[model samples]
Target chain A: MTRYKAVIQYDGSDFLGYQIQATGRTVQEEIQKALTKMHKGQKTVVNASGRTDTGVHAKGQVIHWDSPFSIPVEGYYRGLETLTPDDIAIVSVEEVAADFHARYDVSGKEYRYFVKRSPQHDPFSRHYALRYPFDLDESLMNQAARILEGEHDFTSFCSARTDRESKVRNLYAIKIMPTEDGWIFSFSGSGFLYNMVRILVGALLYVGQKKLTPAEIKVALDKKDRTALVSRTAPPQALYLWEVFYEKDNKK
Target chain B: MTRYKAVIQYDGSDFLGYQIQATGRTVQEEIQKALTKMHKGQKTVVNASGRTDTGVHAKGQVIHWDSPFSIPVEGYYRGLETLTPDDIAIVSVEEVAADFHARYDVSGKEYRYFVKRSPQHDPFSRHYALRYPFDLDESLMNQAARILEGEHDFTSFCSARTDRESKVRNLYAIKIMPTEDGWIFSFSGSGFLYNMVRILVGALLYVGQKKLTPAEIKVALDKKDRTALVSRTAPPQALYLWEVFYEKDNKK
Candidate 1:
């Protein structure tokens, strides 16, 4: 048996999420369906580094699966390129060690939340970026983001649906950069909980609006209460899984 | 009656063209429909600066219509904004002089043709840019573009379907600029004939590919024959009506 790793990109606009569900479409289902068709009637499974919510995009998602048949890597790519949906594409593929597992080997992750502050609705880019039609103080937003730059129990930022026992996670970096189009909030961390990045963005937006002080973020984290957040969770459309890092020599 | 002028933007991916047809939806049809709805079934006619082909986008298209009811400019804008299609939007509106005309008062126009040279199709921007998977010599393309930068009878470049009496037009400027994602060919001219810009872009692409010499562009213009061109017309989706200039004071 040969284990193969794949780098993937997806629009995620029409997908339910990264994982499979009883109803609605998913990125995992599309890949598994393509692999199943490639292997005739045999079942094929793939494990991804993480999951992304509906309407969230990804440019560098990683996944691994053991092939039932030892076909050439090019052959596998050709089959996937022909069978996969238009919105989903495999950018590159490589053969990996038999013991290698995508989710278990993942070391870190990076995510970005895009925003456009405009008084009028931008119909063209509405699907890709959040349009906030109000003024936001950039200095306050930055100060609030600085408070989240270390390890903490991120229970207040995570959604209630997450059943993970440990809420502790380390955030390596967080910053807000202005782009020609708008602003982008970048986050890199060891791991993220369900909607953790989105909720954190929501809190930063409130700080920018002057509705919440930067000190409140520390209180929310210390109290371990989700409702302590001053703002609602940000929408999924503006969120993107930028990259996934793994241990060992990270080639291909 | 107040003469109202509107500067508009549209995606044009699903539009047939800017002109009304016997069947199929046009930008004009949508605007007219919105105006009719605003006027309680009263017929409203709008005059556009120029007609764009199927799937051609516009960042700043100008149009004028005489309002049936004397309403404030904001009122007209509000009604159109609420009734217009999602793909089409008015950026700004103003009340113009009584003698103002959208088409007849036009002095010049600026068009932009976007090109992406890539081996793979970009599904994200595929609807807006033309993808040509070939190496293009920008120097050669610029040389070819320079030869057509003056007043000339563009009989060879104009489509055969055009019935304009005089084929003479002044091309004030033509230059190719590189973008972060792709290349853009900008053309600012006093006037353009039907399919003139697309056909010019086609010939420039051939010149860039070394299939045709840059000097041959001058020959085609001198020949004044439609069939003398070396390349096919570029697609309409990649073309954009960037700006329109009106004579004296430049108002409606």
Candidate 2:
């Protein structure tokens, strides 16, 4: 059996997230079905660095799968390109050791959320961006982002239904970059809990609107209660899984 | 009565072009309906810079409309903000002379066409871009574009159904700029014939693929026979009316 690592990009608008559900379309099921068809009755299981929710997007999502055939690494690209829908693309592929795993391997991830602050909606950008009509103070938002960095129990920012018992995680960095079009809030971390990035972005957005001060973010962090943080979640369309980094010399 | 010149932007995915059509939704009809809604019992007519085809987008389309009431220019912005659908936005509004016309007094117009050269289809970008899998020689495309500049009778490029009597027009410039993501084709012209821009882009694209040569474009121009030019019409989604330039102090 050969294991292959694939870097994928997808527009998650028409998908019910990455995982296969009983109802609705999914990215995983579509790719796995394609693989099964290509292999002629051989079942295939695919794993990803992380599972994204419905309506979310990804630019550099990484995944791995085992195949019965001894296919060249380049063949994986061409095969997936032909099999996957237009909304999904396998950007790159490489063969890995038998033990290599996409989700289990040691690594970190980065995510970005975009918000459009203009009062008038830009028809061209409406789908990919979250529209916020209120005026935002970028400096204030930047100040709030600093509080999110470092290791802490991010219970307040995580979804309440997250199955993990340990809510503590290390946040490597958080930066808010203002662009001509809008603001991009980027977060890098060892890992993220369900809806953690979206909730964190929501809290910072409130700070930018002066609904909450920079100090409020610290209070929310210290409280460690879900209700302590801002409840409004950023729209999934504006969120994107940007990259995944893994430890070198690790083979599948 | 007062007239206002408004700069508009629209996605155009759901619009049947800028003209008012009997059987389909149109940008002009939508804007007029919005205006009539705001000024109850008052009918308003809107004149646009030019008519755009179905699925063609706009970023800086200019229009002029007369109103019986003297509405503040900012109110025009706010009113449109409330009335226009999410797919349309009034970027700016300025009071203009009663004689000012959106289509007649134009000095020059700028339009852009986008082509996604990658093999992968982007779900988020499906409504706004044209994807071409074949490799295109940018240098060759630029060479063909240069030949399209200056005045010529573009009968070979215009749609057969175009209602214009004279097919001669001045093409101020045709520039193909390479962007990090895709190619940006910009055309500045005094005026354009029906389906002219799409045909021009199609021809350039064919040249880029080595199917046609720059010299062939010159030959097509010289022939002036509609059948002499390439028949493939570029998709409308990739085209955008970026700007309409008029003389300053022209009171428009």
Candidate 3:
């Protein structure tokens, strides 16, 4: 069996998430279904870089799967185009090492969260941005974002349902940019917990509204307690998994 | 009774068109419904600058409505917010003279048509731009567009369903801009016939594909024959009623 890695882009509007669930269509199920069809009815399991919550879009999601029969990398791209749904596209496919793993080999990730501050109804922007009528102060939000970089116990910024052994993660950088409709908060990190990026963005948004100060965010991080956080989790529609990075030299 | 001239913006996805049809929701119908609710069972009629085809969006569509009540202009803005649907917005409203008309008194109109050439899936741009898979030659299209400017018989570039007395119209400018994903063609003119803009854009796209020449477009205009045109009509979703211009002194 040959292993192949594929880069994916999808609109998460109708997807439950990246993982399998009891009900609702998911990104994972759709890709696996397509693979099974291409493999002549034999089931094929695919692994992804990470799981994105419902309504979260992706541009450069990475996945790897073993093919039951040998096929050219270009064959996958040409074949999947006819099989995948309108909202999903196979960006690129490449032959990978037999032991390559999509999820375990990931080294870093980048995510973007868009917020539309304008009250005007822009039908086009509504699909990609979370519209917030409440005013936001950019300087305060930027200050809070800067303080979020580096290793920290992100327990306060993760979903309460998470039960990881350790809540520590390394954040490489955070960039806040003012867009035409509103602002986009970009996060690059070694790893993120469940709902971690959304929670981190929500906290900065609170700072922008002047409800919480930069010092308050620092204190919340030091406490490492979810209950001590003042920011509510942001919605899922505006969040996007921009890219997933993997080390080339770390071949299995 | 007080006459109010309102600037409107609406998404045309759920709308049949700007005109009242036998069934299905229209932009005019939605605004009229909102007004009827504000007037407490009093049916309201709104006259618009012009009608847009089904699935055509608008940003600065002007309309005039005579109200049974003499309400404050500011109050109308606040009141209409709750009455209007999520996809529609009353951008501005002001009291106008009783003699002022939205349709006949118009000076000029600006229409924007977007064409997305890339095949990649961008969920955000999908709502506003029409996707075209074939390659387009920018210079050939621009040359054809320049020849289309000036007063001429536009019968070949109008919907055959139209029954206007005169087909002669003056075009002020035609600007073709290449965007990141594709191209946007902007047209400014004294007035446009039924489906004139879309038909004109369709002809230009054919030129970009090397199916026709700029000289052939001029010949089609000279013939004033609808059957002389070879390009197919463009879709409505990519067409936007950008703005309506009026004399500054014509204010009511």
Instruction: Give me the candidate number with maximum DockQ.
Output: 2
Q: Which stretches of candidate 2 lie over 4 Å from their true place?
A: A41-45, A69-71, A116-120, A131-143, A178-182, A248-252, B20-25, B41-45, B115-143, B208-211, B230-232, B246-252
With a 3 Å backbone cut-off (N, CA, C), the pairs that clash in candidate 2 are A97-A252, A98-A252, A99-A252, A100-A252
Query: In terms of TM-score, how similar is model 1 to the real structure?
Result: 0.88
lDDT of 3 by residue, A55-133 (tens): 8999889999998788888899988767888778889899888888889989999999989888666665555788888
Which digits, one per residue and each the tens of the lDDT, describe model 2 over residues A33-89?
878877787989899998999999998888888889988877778888888887897
**Candidate 1: tens digits of C-alpha lDDT, residues B140-176:** 9988888999999999999989999999999999989
The DockQ-based CAPRI class assigned to model 3 is acceptable
Question: Using TM-score as the measure, what is the rank order of every candidate, best first?
Answer: 3, 1, 2
The segments of candidate 1 whose C-alpha lies over 4 angstroms from its true place after superposition are A14-26, A29-44, A74-86, A163-166, A248-252, B20-26, B40-43, B117-121, B160-166, B248-252
TM-scores, one per candidate: 0.88, 0.87, 0.90
| Candidate 1 lDDT, A1-252, residue by residue in tens | 788898888887789989999999999999999989988968899899988889998888999998878878888888887798877877878888888878988899999999998876655665578988777898988888888889999999999888999999999898899887678999999999889999999999888888888898878888888887868899998888989998676443
DockQ of 1: 0.31
> Model 1 residue A211 lDDT?
80
Q: Any runs in candidate 3 off by more than 4 Å, and if so which?
A: A20-25, A41-43, A117-119, A132-139, A248-252, B21-25, B117-121, B132-135, B248-250
lDDT of 3 at A60: 87
TM-score of 2: 0.87
